[model samples]
Structures are given as C-alpha cells and as structure tokens.
Target: MISSEDHARLSQAIREAEDLTTGEIVVVVSEQASSYRSFPVLWALLAALVVPWPLIAITTLGPARIFLIQLLVALFLSIFLSFPSRRHALVPRFIKRARARETARREFLGRGLTRTRERTGVLIYVALAEHHAEIMADTGIADRVGPEVWRGIVDELTDRIREGRLTDGLVAAVRRTGAILAEHAPPRFDDVDELPNKVFVL
Candidate 1:
C-alpha cells in the first residue's frame, strides 16, 4: 500500500538508523498476516443455521425448500464475506494480533535476522489489514533492551498506521529504534552493514 517515493523514504530512514548503531534493522509491511479464510465460512454456517430456523417457524415451506434456501444463503454469505474488508471484520481482534505477531516472528527468522554477526538484528513488522505492528529484537539487543521499550515503539507505529501515515510512522520508529540501540549497542569501529536497508512490502 506504499508508493515508490514512500519506499525510498523508508530506505533512507533505515540507512540513517543503521548509521547510528551496529544493529541491523529490517522493516516489513504486509497486507495481512493471515487470510483468516475460515472466519467467513464459520460466519456463513452460523447464519445459514439461524436463517433456516426462522423460515421453519414462520413459513409453511416444505423441508426441501427450506434446505435449498439455507444452502443459497450460506453460499451467498460466504462469497460476500470473502472480500478482504468483510473477511477481516469476521475475525476477532485477538486472532488478528496473534496472527500478525506470528507473522512478524516468522519474517524475523526467514530474513536471517538471527544470523547477524553480533546477533543484534531487529525487525520492525507492520501488518496493515490486521492493524498490528511488532518490534522483534535478536539476542544481542534483547539482552540489553526490555520488551516494554519495544512495545512503546510498536504502539507509536500502530497509531500512525491508524492515521493513514504508514511511511511517517516507520521513519519515526526507525529513528527511535536507532536511538535506543545507540545507547545500548553502540557501533563498533569495525562494524559493517550486514542487512539490506530497504522496506519489504509483502
């Protein structure tokens, strides 16, 4: 959902952030963490079950007709809920957060953040559709910084995303993360850039 210009801005932010500390920062923005496909199906099934009851009680329709109507309702509602917006609505907030958090962890590992020379890698992940964000730090940095500090960064990024300023939020987050790492994990004279300074939009 970010434009090329915004991508450039994020890349610049990453580069600048990494300039301050030895920590390698990776930014990933995803359309969604999980498809949540089953939520729509479950909703459709529930609707169909409740709908047939009303038809059976109010109308003298035959069992065959009521069954057909139930099938039709289920089919229609399932298709309707398949839309991204509708499907997202059918999922609970906790489920969304859990999926997003899991996705962030997977991305952290998949991106080789753990393999950095000093184990000082950080992943700032944002899932737009889920309205969630997470900051994951590798062992080196995690040993020095607390989870509450990262939680504050995630909270700010989420608020900016809610305000429709995704790029701005990321830039701010990167800068803040850099400041923290500068304090806890200052760059070494022989430090080298070990990760790409680009935003991965999935």
Candidate 2:
C-alpha cells in the first residue's frame, strides 16, 4: 500500500534512528495477514441454501421459481463478495487483529529481530487491510520500557494511520522508539549493524 516516495522516506528514517542506538528497529507492512479466501464461496453457498427455506415456508412459489430465485440470490451475493473491500469487511474484527498480531510476530522472527546481540530488536508492524498496527519488542528493551509505553506508541500510530498519515506515523514512531533506545541502549564501541533498515513489505 505504500508508495515509492514513502518507502524511501521510511527507509531513511530507519537509518537515522539506528544511528544513535544499538537497538535494532524493523518495520513491516502487509496487505493482510490471511486471505480468509473461502469466505466468499461460503457466503454464496449459504445464501443459496437459505433462500429455498424462506421460499418454501413463506411463499407458495413453485419448485422451479424457488430454485431460480435461489440461484439468483447466490449469484448476486457471490458477485458482491468478489470485491476485495466487501470480502474484507466480512472478516471478524477479532480474527483480523489476531491474524495481524500473528503475522507481525512471524515477521519479527523471520527477519531475525529476535536474534540481535542484545535482545533489543523492535518491530513496527502494520496490516493495511485490517487497519491494524503492532509494536513487537524484544526482552532487552521491554524490560526497560513498560507495557504502557509500547501501548502509547501503538495507539498513536494507529490514530495517524486512520488519518491517512501512515508514512508520517511510521517515521514518528521510529524516532520516538529510537530516542527511548538511545536512552536505554546507547551505541557501544563495538556495536554492530545487526539488521537491515529497509521497510519490509508482504
């Protein structure tokens, strides 16, 4: 969902953020955690299955007409669900959040954020389809920064995203997190660039 210009700016922000701290920060964006791909077909089938019942109970429609009506209902609903926006809306809120968090955690591990020398890697993750964001922190940093601190950053970033300021929100979150890391884990003489600074997109 990010544009080319935004990607460059976000990468630059990451570069700057890592300059003053040994802690590693990674950002990842995903179109969606899971497709929930079968939902549309299920909805269409359900629409077809349910139509016959109402037709049989409430109306004196003949079998042929009822079947035709059921077929039409199924076709219409299937076509409606073919739209990505409509299909996404059918996914439950809890499922969306859970999937986003799961995906973020997977990325944290997949990108080697958990293997940093000081256990100080943090991930700023966004799932655009669900409009959800998560901040995943490793033990070294979370031990110093309370849960409330991380919550505040997630909340603020979510608000900015809702306002359509994703790039700005990410940069601000990176800077804010960088300041906190600099305070708790300032660069050492032997500090290494343990991870890349690019914005990971999936």
Candidate 3:
C-alpha cells in the first residue's frame, strides 16, 4: 500500500513535470495473483462420466461405436451442467446483482468508490481495494512496449500520486507521454491524395 506522503510527493512531481488538470493514477501494491482456480469436484464429475466407456464397449459392436456414444453423452452432460455450475460456482458471490447493490453501498460508505469491469478482448477489471486500487489495461500494451517499460509507466504513475495533486499530475503525464510517443513513433496515414491526371481509361 502507498502511504499518503508518497502519493502526495508523486502527485507533485507529475504536476511539475507535466501540465495536467484532471486524471487518475494507478498504483499496484503487489504482483497480480492468478485468477484461475482448480475445481476438483468438477474434474471428478467429468471423469466419472467417462468411466462407463469400457462397459459400453463390451456390450457394443465395436470400440469406435462405443467411443462415439460416450463422446455424445459427455458432450450432452457438459452442456447440461455447465450453466448452473457457472452461476453457483464460477462467479463471485458479491458480483451477483442483489449482492452487488449491497456491496456497492458498503464500498461507497468506506472508500467513496465503486467497482467496474472493463472488457478488452477478455474482461479486465478495475476495483478499489482495502489500501490501494488497480488499473487494468489490455495485454496489447505489453506487446507494444514490452514489460519493463510498461511497468515503468505504472511505477511513474504511482509516483505521481505522492504529490497531493493526483488529477493534475496524471493529466500532465498523459499529455506529455502522448507527445513523446507521437514524436518517436512512426507516422500513420489514412488515405493518400490522388493526382487528378493520374486516372487511366481501361
């Protein structure tokens, strides 16, 4: 978690270096944790559905026939059970509509902020936490600038928050960064102007 003193100092640096009035700075306090969870029960259930394949084979004409039947059964079962399991198991409890309303009230009272989900290719998230907040961008940024620069950018943003002028600091950082990028990056043209006499009669 970033101390208020640090936030103020960073904010001041950004304000002095860049000319900004309104924006936000994101400070990641720790490494991002993996979001995937292992569901033993779900895996076991799926395995159980395949266990009868041998019995089907011995009672049938050939292995291929038995395998095809088992495949169909598995597909059917997967489709049938996936939806309810997702609603009950996959989604976070606090994210359900009714629960979200209650959670939002508590969050507003405590932090004066709310959570929001952003979609870019896949769903990314931006949420206020106990001591800090997160800013999520698409994976493409890493591809474009590489991880080191990307991390540096995030760190710079976090540093700017220390100045006690988050809004102005961020705005200036964004504008100046954009200018630097524009200067160093290659030019892009949408359409070329055609010469009037260059048309050919075919």
Candidate 4:
C-alpha cells in the first residue's frame, strides 16, 4: 500500500532514528492482517437463509421456486458483499483489533526484533485495512518504559492513518520511538546495525 517514494522516506526515517539509540526499530506496514473471506460467505449465507423464510411465509410459490430464490439471493449477496469495505463492515471491531495485534506480534518475532543485542528492539506495526497501529518493545526498553508511552504513540499513528497520512504518521512514530529509546537505551560504543532499517510492506 506504500509507494516507492514513501518506502525510501520511511527507510531514511528508520536510519535517522537508529542513529541515536542502540535499539533496533523495524516498521511493518500491511494492507491487512487477515483476508476475512469467511465474512462475505457468512453474510451471504445468513441473508439467503433469512430471505427464504420470508418468501415461504408470504408467498404461495412452490418449494423449488423458493429454494431457487434463496440460491439467487445467496449468489447476489456473495458478489455484493465480496467488496473489501462491505466485508470489513461485517467483521467485529474486536476481531479486527485482535488480528492486527496478532499480526504485529508475529512480525515482531519473525523479524528478529527479539534477537537484538541487549534485547532493545522495537517494532512499529501498522495494518491499513484494519486501521490499527501498534508498538512492540523488547524487555530492554519495556523494562524502562511504561505501556502508556507506547499506547500514546499508537494513538497518534492511528490518527495519522485515519487521516490518510500514513507516511507522515510512521515517520513521527519512528522519531518518537527513537527519542524514547535514546533516553532508556542510548547507543553503545560497540553498537552495530542488527536489523534492516527499512519498512517491510506486506
């Protein structure tokens, strides 16, 4: 969902952020956390099932005709609800947040954020489809920082995403995270780049 220009800018932001702290910051932006294909199917099925009941109650149509109408309703709904916005609407907010969090956690581990020296790695993850953002801090930083700090960053990032300022939001989040890390885990003399300072767009 990010352009090449935005990618370059995000990478630059990461590099600058890493300059002041030993902490490894990785940013991941994903189009979505989950496909949620089942949502369209579930909605289509429910609408079809309900449609047949009303027809059965009010119409003198034969059972076969009623069944055919139900099938057609299901087909139409499946096509209409297959749209991304429609499908997303069918999913509960809690489910979207949970999936986004899970995706963030997976990215944090899969990207080796936990394997950094001194365990001072932080992951800034954004899921565009779910309109969610999260910051994951390893023990080295988390022990020194409170959850409220991360929450505040997430809130700002989410606002930016909602305003269609994703790149701007990410850049700000990276800077803020770097400042926090610099305070808690300033660069070491032997500090080396332990992770790729680039935005992973999934």
Q: How does each model score on lDDT? A: 0.93, 0.90, 0.35, 0.92
RMSD of each: 1.3, 2.0, 18.0, 1.4
Estimated TM-score per prediction? Answer: 0.94, 0.89, 0.27, 0.94
Q: What's the distance in Å from true for residue 88, model 2?
A: 1.2
Winner on TM-score (3 vs 4)? 4
Candidate 2 at 83: error in angstroms?
1.0
Candidate 3 per-residue lDDT, tens place, 99-195, comes to 4334333433333112211111111111222112222323322234444543454455555555544444344444444333333332234322111
Per-residue C-alpha lDDT of model 4 across residues 1-202, encoded as one tens digit per residue: 7899999999999999899999999999999999999889888999888886777788889989988988998999988999998889999999999999999999999999999989999999988888888899999999999999999999998888888899999999999999999999998899999999899999
Per-residue lDDT of model 2, residues 8-98, tens digit only: 9998998898999999999998888888777877899887998888778898999999989988988888888978898998888998899
Task: Look at candidate 2 and tell me the lDDT of residue 50.
Answer: 82
Off by over 4 Å in 4: none
> Which sections of candidate 2 miss by over 4 Å?
58-72
Better of 3 and 4 by lDDT: 4
Which is the better candidate, 2 or 4, if ranked by TM-score? Answer: 4
Give residue 4's lDDT in candidate 1 (0 to 100).
96
Candidate 1 regions with alpha-carbon error over 4 angstroms: none
96-188 in candidate 1: lDDT tens per residue? 999999999999999989999989999999998888889999999999999999999989988888898999999999999999988888889
